[model samples]
Target: MSSVHVEPVIAGAARETWLGGSLKAFREDPLALLCELHRASGDVAKFRLGPKKLYAVFNPDMLKEIMVTKAEAFCKGGTFAEIKRLTGEGLVLSEGELHKKQRRLIQPKLTRSHINRYAEQMVASTLAHLETWGDGQERDLAVDMMKITFDIIARTMFSYDSKHAQDQIARAFDSINHIATRKIRALVKLPLFIPTNENREYIQALRVLDDTVYGLIRQRKAESSLEREDLLSVLMRATDESSQEGMSDEQLRDEIMSMFLAGHETTAHSLTWTYDYILQNPNVEEKLMNEWKHVLNGRRPTVNDYPALTYTQNVIWETLRLRPSGYVTSRTALQDVEIGSLQLIKGDTVMISPYPLHTSERYFDDPLTFRPERFEQDRMKELPQMAYFPFGAGPRSCVGQHFAMLEMVLILASIGQQYRIKRSSTQGALIPEALLTLSPKGGLRATVHRL
Candidate 1:
């Protein structure tokens, strides 16, 4: 376990004296205010986001120390509890051995080999969509990538042969995002959602999502197709190693919704940012193109090409650093803890803002610049550990990080090899829309050109 260099950061603000603070900043625009906080407080700053909610621990070293060292002392917090309104007891909110068991059961579906088998699906779906684009026309790259990725994950995970399956899965994801953001932004946390018409709509959306996902699970079981190699089938058949517990129908709903919620937008944002970076830095795109053209030899790139595809990885890493989709994570202290002289009572929300940490002046030299070469294996080793956490670190770290990275790499190589990306307009600063995941406030726009 790592210990943060105990630097005292104190706040006179009582738990009752809390103003909007970090949560308000999050409500305003999540990224900008967090960067401001990083500048104001050093390693472990004290913040009051929303009334009475004290958010401490905003630095990397302390991030690891708390999330790993004292992780049990901190669970998902009210933010996570709030998420349970929609997600139920899915892996995202579930704690204790149950989480471990659930993660173990689902782990095999996202293994490297299983994901690699899905590479062809990613490539084929991406090309099929790109083929419809006309030359020099502007398009919202964010929406297009969302459509492409949503379709790809379905095929790779559910063998998306029918329009209905794809539509149900995609609708579930969109509906969930809408409900989550609305719930997260509400001023009063608890069951306050019931009386408001705004939250009333979310209830309807959740039901729609539940129905569609449940129907798919049932339909697949009934069909019992011989061609059931997708992640959905894999998950449907998964059982705990010891107790032999399997996902119940409701449990399956939670897991499917969790997968749908977890996968789509984050990967879409990475690719969107990657596309934006390649557009701005023509040299980087050209280098990636050269690598793809040479190694692929006109065939679609595969896992075999990953090692040689260094620059492609560079672009993705740089995007993750600059515009990571996992902008902020919250952990509530379950036990009193002290860091330096600051004494923490339980119930304080520790806000982990990676956007500020990743771009922190102390951490990355010229952190704002778009340079993929910074991720060169040797160069990456120079930084202090946990300073960069697109997927976070520790026991609760994202289980699907490897799957996402592979999906991004495979898609970038296949698509970049076949097309040249041009800047449609640089209208946004990768603005942090920070709802459930960090998203661009304005749509991500770029022009796609053929090789």
Candidate 2:
């Protein structure tokens, strides 16, 4: 620790005040600020948020170190701390031994073989939702994707079929997300116990969500002997080797809530962005539809068909590269360490903004272009490993990555086979907002045309 020297601060730090600096720009649009810093200061940059100093690392090697190689020296920080309020000590928020144990227990359930069984449900839910869309009717495609994904998660993950239950969970998530963004951006924090209107609403929303989740847990426990393949049942049956005990009711709630929030929101936003980009790029859409036509020939997509839909998978990979739903991942240094030439002290916060890295000229050729062909086998292997980590990398990478990708590919194939979506209005450009996940500002407005 003593051998490491203080790293150079990013230029312009001298002109920054306690409240000024990059704070204003960051508050307004963090993505823009990060891009600017990466461009101006090169790979490693440092800035202050009030009294605390933060580091932004854009170098692919450094990112790999922070996320993979020396990952043990870091812990989830920044936004994740805020997320803990909703997910508690679930796999997403847990650390050290608990995270390893929980991850090990849950890993088998999301394996390719296990997730393949959910493919039928994914296609069914997506097709059912598309039935509600009438031709020439303008719809918020973002919200529509959200509903479909939520429905898929409900039916396949928990075997929950009641529309009322789905609606309750969706509304609760919306409320929680709204409050989370506000709290994360606020300069000063307010105690949750405060009787303010926002705080009160947060509590109410939490209560609704808790009631729904806990009720499901109780119901499942009552029927523990049933043979079910749903995620909830699998988790209920998962016994920790050391203790030979399954999770408690509270732990079950936390894990379920974590998966619900993570699985549904990120996938929905990714699909929304994928559609937006496809509509914006006709060639890609044409190629995708051609593949679907060649493969499915107007029939529904299934897990077996995924292998033949090569171009559709490429489009999804491209969308993830351009507009990763989990755009920014952060960590706190647990011990003083050297990341390349830069030295980080214990307690230093490090931010890895994949949004900028994916768009940077250093990694991809014509980084801003919507080119799916870049993901072709030969070309994709040409790039550095960490250059396009939408789901992150290493031990803590998203556990549901396979499940999410399969869902996206299936939904795209099913919907793309049936309709051609076009932007309803050629007005303003779509704005990206950082909420719980990266989502289009307002909603993606488009009209569905039956093919």
Candidate 3:
């Protein structure tokens, strides 16, 4: 176990104001605000948002204490609490024994063997979606990334194949994500019962989500035999070792919904950001094509090829390091616990944003530049465990990490094999929309050239 030592709080850490301390800055630009706070203060910067006390944790050892060593003393807080409205008691929001059990139940489905099976669908889905594109066609690459990832997750996880149904769920996700992001940054939150236009839109979106998910559950349950290999079927068939019973309909819904949100959303944004970086660095793009050619040899990617695709994997890691989709995650102290020398109250929220830690000069040389070689084997072993955690760390880390990684590699290689997506010269500087997920602002407009 790693021991956390208290480092002296820097004299000029960002402080809370009489009202909403730092909330205005956070709302205007969270990424910039977090970066500023870390630069101004050292590791443990204390600030505020309205009545909430927030400690922006940047030190890797302290992060380990909060996420791993003393993890039991904290529960999901900040935007995670707000997301529960959509996720319910899903893996992302659940706590204590329930979280443990849910993790046990779902972990097996995302194992290496299961992820290998998912790769086939991932490639097929990408290829199928690619058929819709043409040589020299211009498209919003962000939208393209989302649609293909949505399709991949739908087929690979649930065996769902209805394009119409997929589109409906995608639209609902858009509405829900928009409202959720607004609520996260909103100084004042309106209760769901108020039925304001936004509230009503939120409610309707929830209705659509619940209806679609439950309808799938009901439809799956009604099947004569539930022996399929998809994640949904496997989950439906899994029995708790202690209880010798399966999950309830509601439990399945929560897990499935969790997967739906985490499975596709993070990967899509990652691909978007990866391409954005690739467009910025021509040498990186050429290296990627060379590696793909050497390993894949103008052929489709497979699970067997993963080991040989080291550089390709490094690109994904570098992209994730630079623009992690879930840029910030938070945890509230579950009790009066002492982390390092700082005493945290039961409800004090500790915000952990990966952007600062990932981009810090302490972690990487020339941190602002996009360099996949930084993740090369020998260099990776020297970094701290908590450094460069794009998918996060500890027990509460992403459940479908393997699934996401393989999916990213296969999709990137597949796309690179057949087409080159370049940024449009007319498209001005891209901005990072620091919503729930960090994505390219106004979408990434680019031309797709067939190779």
| RMSD of every prediction | 5.5, 6.2, 5.0
User: What is the lDDT, from 0 to 100, of the residue 362 in candidate 3?
Assistant: 97
Residues 370-404, candidate 1: write the lDDT tens digits: 77777876786777677787887787888888778
- TM-score, cand. 3 vs. native: 0.94
- Which parts of model 2 are misplaced by more than 4 Å? 1-15, 224-226
lDDT of 2 at 244: 89
TM-score winner, 1 or 3: 3
Error of 3 at 51 (Å): 0.8
- Please write out the lDDT profile of model 2 over residues 1-451, one tens digit for every residue: 0011111212332334667566656666677778878887898889865555789899888899999999999999665777888899899889999899889878888899999999999999999988989988888888888888988888888988746676677778888887987787776879898899999989998999889889888887788384787878878888888788988988889998998889899999899888777777677777887888899989999999988888888778888877788877788999999899989889899988887788877887777777778777768677778888989998999999999989999999988878888888853556777777787777888988887
The per-residue C-alpha lDDT of model 3 at residue 2 equals 10
> How many residue pairs collide in each prediction?
0, 0, 0
Instruction: Indicate which candidate wins on lDDT.
Output: 3
TM-score on alpha carbons, each prediction: 0.87, 0.93, 0.94
Could you tell me the lDDT of residue 216 within candidate 3? 90
Q: After superposition, how far is residue 68 of candidate 2 from its true place, in Å?
A: 0.8
- Candidates 1 and 2 compared: the better one by TM-score is 2
Model 3 residue 258 lDDT score:
87
Clashes of 2: 0
Judge candidate 3 at residue 200 and give its lDDT: 95
